[model samples]
Target: MKFALTLVSGLLFNSIAQAGVGTELVADGFERPVWVGAPDSVKGKIWVMEQAGTVWIVDLKTGKKAEEPFLKIVPKVERKGNEQGLLGLAFAPDFAESGRYYVNYNEKGGETQIVRFVTEDGKTTDPDSGETIFQYDQPYANHNGGWLDFGPDGLLYVATGDGGSANDPKNLSQDLGSPLGKLLRLDVTGKEGYKPAEGNAFAGVDGALPEIHAFGLRNPWRCSFDAETGDFWIGDVGQNAWEEINVVKGNKTGGLNFGWRLREGDIKTPGRKGKEIGGKIPENYHAPIYVYAHGSGGTQGLSVTGGYVYRGSAVPDLKGRYIFADYQNPRIWSLREKGGKSTDFQDHTKALQPDGGRISLISSFGEDASGELYITDLTGPVYKIVEK
Candidate 1:
């Protein structure tokens, strides 16, 4: 499916009300569902990734999950940490012919691995067919950024978190040599070793890894491209006080710093104290488009879950509005940006309530082939956003 980029004008907060938005239960009995996606070849089938190392296909028409998993590798995955497991999945844009898909997961030894697999049949994958693309040793377990996506340019984009620990102790986010804490774009179409995509900012720069597309990210738990505009959106998890949502124009390539340990969500964070040669904040950094505090007060949120901009016709009011949520608070919000700044925002949690009850631990948000939105809860069950 192809989408055209169009700028929306005259959009006001009062005109786009949240009352028309709601959630409908689609599937249940999932184990720590973290990511969800759909292949372009499949019309109504949605592929869901469970953190415990399994993938399931759900038929939207019947609202039933396939009894047999699409893929399973529990024995090879390590799920000891709250964030570890089979983290991400993305289907090749030419999946109809190639039958290829990619996954990012933590290996049994706590190392991160990106692998490509092929489906023997149309519906399922052979466990032995996985071909390792690359693997990296993770210094800590907590912030393994897990998101795989195919950009409109036909390249694979990978999100990696800073090597875990409080406040990025090793200052890895700013280190150009390390792959951790960076967004990478690779030409995965080749069968052998991967190559950095053309126009990468650090392609031939000295002391910089060629694969680094963008750096200085803490834990970009979830990120997606706007199907309509091709612009990139990222939800970078914060340290203690704030959560941020960042946007990179679709035309820009790389060398964009997101200000991780130096500045967390527009506030200059204190430098590492009581240590030898504490880290210095870089002068060049990109601030998030929008940010919210982490607290019990009104409009405060915890752990931003990056989501998609509604381009589906089902929700007319949501068109062009970016829908996202808080993993800790379970509240959903819609943000409208104009001229690279947020213009309107609304809390839609109450509108999404099916029984005056909130959906808890929203792990991820997904977009279907038709552009409709779906969300997965870590507790269990998947819900589709619909007209109330």
Candidate 2:
């Protein structure tokens, strides 16, 4: 493990020296844009994903959305619920040479599909060329944990939610047999359509699926790996009392069980009844790095929206801190990770919300090939992090 950290079950109350960072509008006029990113080989452009089944290419220099979408599969996509639709996209490591990319979307009958497509010119891809490499049925619509990306190891990592209901009705998070409620590692090549990524935790284990890398997640919203350190970071949305941020350091990559159903944030999940509602908490559960209480209203949490660690040249103060926020509350914050503890905690909410603009509904955060960070709010605006 490259890091060591304990879980924090309550709100951070430290008022330390602030990181001099803010956001500027990068592009606007998108429809429920859920993610934005670009391949390392590509520069000056980023692809934005709309939850309603569209991928748009935006020019960073012009700050304009592309006239035509890079990818569209709305007719095949089933976007009936709030959580279902085209949720993620990742360009292959060798995308510059191979022009291959992948997407994660929900099918008509509530199935999660991982499809691969080839782009001749790297600008657009034909839906006809897309092939579903992996698929699985989703029991419910709400907790469709749809986030996928290529890690530093060039393997595809996917986040999935537990069988969705209050307090994990089926307790799928702890079930080794199911792929639900787990982070999956997959390898994709020309010959092997889709298989377990090498060194996956359950590759040779009996009964468990080989694709599983880490298990026991409630609804991981948006996650990213530190471009510099390779450490994994995620914002796992909580059920009742809290919202959390979890980190698994770089060198150690598999066999992690983040307690859910049985544990939310750092405490036992408080369900409709009490903490006794879910099953037993494991002896050695991997706890969240940070947790915060619900935003006043008990109805929904300040749902966590995970973001990347800033490594761009523009912001020296925010150079190595992990920045993240919530959906319902939408207040952004940054904290330094040292010795497995969060220090130098700074609230970047006021600074990020520029000139009376609101980032009220954060869907996800993005990073381009240049290591700059961007935020995608469900409402339409995509903002870039800048020195303020």
Candidate 3:
């Protein structure tokens, strides 16, 4: 159920020769690796999320995967489509003491589930200990937006896609009552039901769902907070014509609307015939800081896989650049932003190429505990970003 988009021509072969950064194969042989993360407390261990409901622990020092899974919930996951399965994972801030973690996935009935689990000894999780934290029905399968990460404020932030189907037939992105197409911040520290964080934009709104932190996003494949500055970045997948990357300054409050059905990447998208809601567009719809068309030409990418801003010391040149990739086109780019504006952009796909060919089907990008970046390919391998 990967989002349906028009296929475009591949990147020019010459471009791969121009990349300045290279990638080293770190691990391979897994089923649809969607994400990779490491707990702050773990120095040399990394966890990789396979789309088919298993998390494998990898030892960075030896590059060997553990004999057993760190966590597995295949029985509860629905993997009938490409977009479903175990999509996200986050380690609690105090993971060393509590041995607790969270995950986002599609359950047996295609519903989105956010559940918490605790590892008794800090190595493996007891499958039976899963505590259901949140559940929501999805009308369509493709745009589930399953990405979750803890913000610098120490609250859980969840991203959900606009309730599926082409052209947003239901206009869910504009509906405050619906959790789809929005970013939600929750205080999950409590053992019972979660509560909206106190300073959330909609916390006290009359008819709005209090959990909402921001609205008007399509399928935000990945979003993350800068560990250094606390700024937020989201790579939002676009419809027929564009792909976008958006940011929320560290100081802004919630309730920022990124124009979706009303507009797509700064261009007005007329409502679909017979499904039009005819609502007035908001005056302050946030525009994407960077956008690329869907085509074979320069600066175009099929689907944007949002990544982290490099804060690691290994690659001095990429220190402050935001790294991202295109899932379909299999190209990587580093965006340099200063004072909330994009200052430079570079394509690094060629540098990441292995002897066989270019990295294909990059499903997601990940950050290790040290802030170094990694890219996961749907076929199997995960590569670490390195200086050429």
Candidate 4:
């Protein structure tokens, strides 16, 4: 049985020229931007992380962007080629007081590292407060997990891609010892820096990172917590055949292995070599709640760029919808469940990158203090998803 549902009464469709749900370009003039963070401590300001390692601060209320890049670590850091560099950021849940935050970036050696830093007087100049929270090696560049958020449980959850270079090599997705291809739960609120969150199912398990909450995933390109339910939605980009979205709710057992090399979507296969002899695997290794073919429509394909569950009041029609986009194309789609089966409800690509820019490559989607969705175009500008 497929667990999917469609919440909207009528689908809001669009074409290449025009969009339906009114997405006004709130900001522009970004250079190869990939991620955005709306830190509440900054008075509802949105911070954007550029591919070149600079963070741009945009004031949401004033429609003004800081003249100087908020923070620039790129000059010293190496971004050799694609799928690397600054990727994710989040303000500490208690940012108003501490003015502390975290960052996700890949080094010149192609390893993913999460670091904690404190801005000096709300400015990003000479950040002398840098602390290494955690670091993981990436075998390839493409699948470095791109988003981080503090869950309702107050644990910091970080997403790491399957050790990259196409096709899971180390099979880290199912290997508990590896942090690759998993959602990690870490206790960063302590004086000890980042430790495994207590009560994590694998915390005491030998040969494990103790921070892992779930495994068996491809590139979890983007993941976010549901506003109302606090459930997690991971858009794991698939290889060649299938794309999947996995749901992880709070306080559940820390081990739901979303099938990857063993099977793509719900299709059972013995191996990635394309053997189809497997009967039925354990239900424990679950399939996607929603799946799509690479040749679905529009671009006829979409690589996962996971986004937030809409909680913005501006778009009452999209209150609970999951908004996501593809990396190869400018097309954006919405997924909602109806009768336990998820369906693509709308296509809002026409309004995306409205300036007709190339390389729409959406690396991440962001949410403000008010819970509105903001998208970062890899080689473009940060856009706010507003109602039409």
Please tell me which predicted candidate would have the highest lDDT against the true structure: 1
**Predicted candidate 1 versus true structure: per-residue lDDT over 1-388, tens digit per residue:** 0000112233234323477788898888899899888987787889888999999999998888888999999998998888889999999998998889999999997899999999867688887789998778889888999888899999999999987877888889888899998999999989776889888878899999888888989899889899989999998998776788888878364788888777777676645555442234566577788887776443566688889888889878789999988888777888887888876777787778666556888899998888889999898788999986
Q: What TM-score against the true fold does each predicted structure earn?
A: 0.93, 0.93, 0.93, 0.87
Clashing pairs in 3: 1-82, 16-350, 161-181
TM-score, cand. 3 = 0.93
Look at candidate 4 and tell me the lDDT of residue 239: 74
Clashing pairs for model 1 are none
What digit string (tens of lDDT, one per residue) describes model 4 on residues 368-388?
878888887765667777766
C-alpha lDDT of residue 15 in model 3: 35
Candidate 1 error regions (>4 Å)? 1-17, 271-284
- Candidate 2 per-residue C-alpha lDDT over 1-388 given as tens digits, one digit per residue, 9 for 90 to 100: 0000223533355433354667889899899999999999988998999888899999999998777789999988888778889988988999999988889889888799999998897777787889899898898887888889889888899998885767788888888789888999999966448878889988888899999988989888888989989999988888867787888887265888899878888787765843466546685478778877775432224578888898878788788989887787667778777767667667777778866688888788888888988999899999998897
Any runs in candidate 2 off by more than 4 Å, and if so which?
A: 1-19, 297-301
CA error at residue 124 for candidate 1, angstroms: 0.8
